[model samples]
Target: AQRVTQPEKLLSVFKGAPVELKCNYSYSGSPELFWYVQYSRQRLQLLLRHISRESIKGFTADLNKGETSFHLKKPFAQEEDSAMYYCALGGRNTGFQKLVFGTGTRLLVSP
Candidate 1:
């Protein structure tokens, strides 16, 4: 079965610290990986996608097909960067592609 794994449930870091949210996935075929984030009072939204190779809010993620991993990274953390991040995998199950979300990682940035 295809699965998305986020081992860390809670991560704490100080302001201006480098942060990395680990994510690993398992699937049979090519997958479209994405990083979704939800701020304190905001709705869940896309942070970035593998194909875009773009960075949103100083965060970047590269999909490693060989390792089946798409890890989110941020050079410097900020208080507002604190949020719940989710790693999602878009893969074909039967007839269409479906999104499989990880458990989620709650990042807390301390001042």
Candidate 2:
């Protein structure tokens, strides 16, 4: 079985604080991992990917094969960055054309 799990429904914090969004996945084979973010009144877009090893909008994610996790992290939370975050897993066997997403975690950045 293959699945992605995001443990939090919401994460609230003050501006300039560190942020971490936990994600865990279970898959049988090599899996492509990604982080997608949706801003207020905007479309969902790819934040980062495990394969690319890139960082977007000051956020970075590292894939840990040993723990089956790919956690998103940022040194400081910004008000503009506040939005809905989702961890995703992509594998050929899932039958989905793209990636399969976790439920999502709402990040609330307040001043």
Candidate 3:
């Protein structure tokens, strides 16, 4: 079985402060990691994918194969960035898409 873990359930940071969300994964095979965020009263959306190598909303995450980690980072955070963030692992068997998500971390950006 594969699992994704977000040790922090809640992260409170001031606006304009740097932030980093820790994520760890356990899997036998190669893992496809992703960060999904859900804003206030908004649907969950992809923040970043390990394969994309792109930054969204001023946040970026790089997959550390050796450590089995994919931590999200942002040089600066905004009040609007307050949201529920989840670390997800995507794997496949045959034609089926299997995913395991972390408990989720709620980021509170205080003004």
Candidate 4:
């Protein structure tokens, strides 16, 4: 079975402070990790992907095979960055390219 686990349900931080959303996965084969964010009433969008190794909206996540973790990070937290963040895992082993998402973490940035 494949699973994505985000231990923190909520991460509160002050403006300009650093932020980190922890994500861990359990899978038998190589996995593709991604971060999805939903702001206000908007639909969920991809924030970053491990294979891309690119940063979007000042956020980045790295996949650590040894630890089976892909944690999202940002040096500074902005009010607009507050959103519902989800960690997802996908791989060929799944047969149909289905993504398994974690419960999700809500980021709260306060002034």
The candidate that wins on TM-score is 4
The lDDT per prediction is: 0.92, 0.92, 0.91, 0.95
Instruction: Write down the TM-score for model 3.
Output: 0.94
Report the C-alpha lDDT of model 2 over 55-104, residue by residue, as the tens digit. 88899999999999999999999999889999999988777656789999
Clashes of 4: 0
Candidate 4, clashing residue pairs? none
Model 4 C-alpha lDDT per residue in residues 16-103, reported as the tens digit of each score: 9999999999998889999999999999999999999999999999999999999999999999998999999999876579999999
| C-alpha TM-scores of all predictions | 0.94, 0.95, 0.94, 0.98
Q: After superposition, how far is residue 96 of candidate 1 from its true place, in Å?
A: 1.6
For model 1, give the 10-residue run with minimal summed lDDT.
90-99
Point out where model 4 deviates above 4 Å. Answer: none
Best by lDDT: 4
Report model 1's TM-score to 2 decimal places.
Answer: 0.94
State how far residue 78 of model 1 sits from its true place (Å): 0.7
Residue pairs in clash, model 2? none
Query: What ranges in model 3 sit over 4 Å off?
Result: 93-95
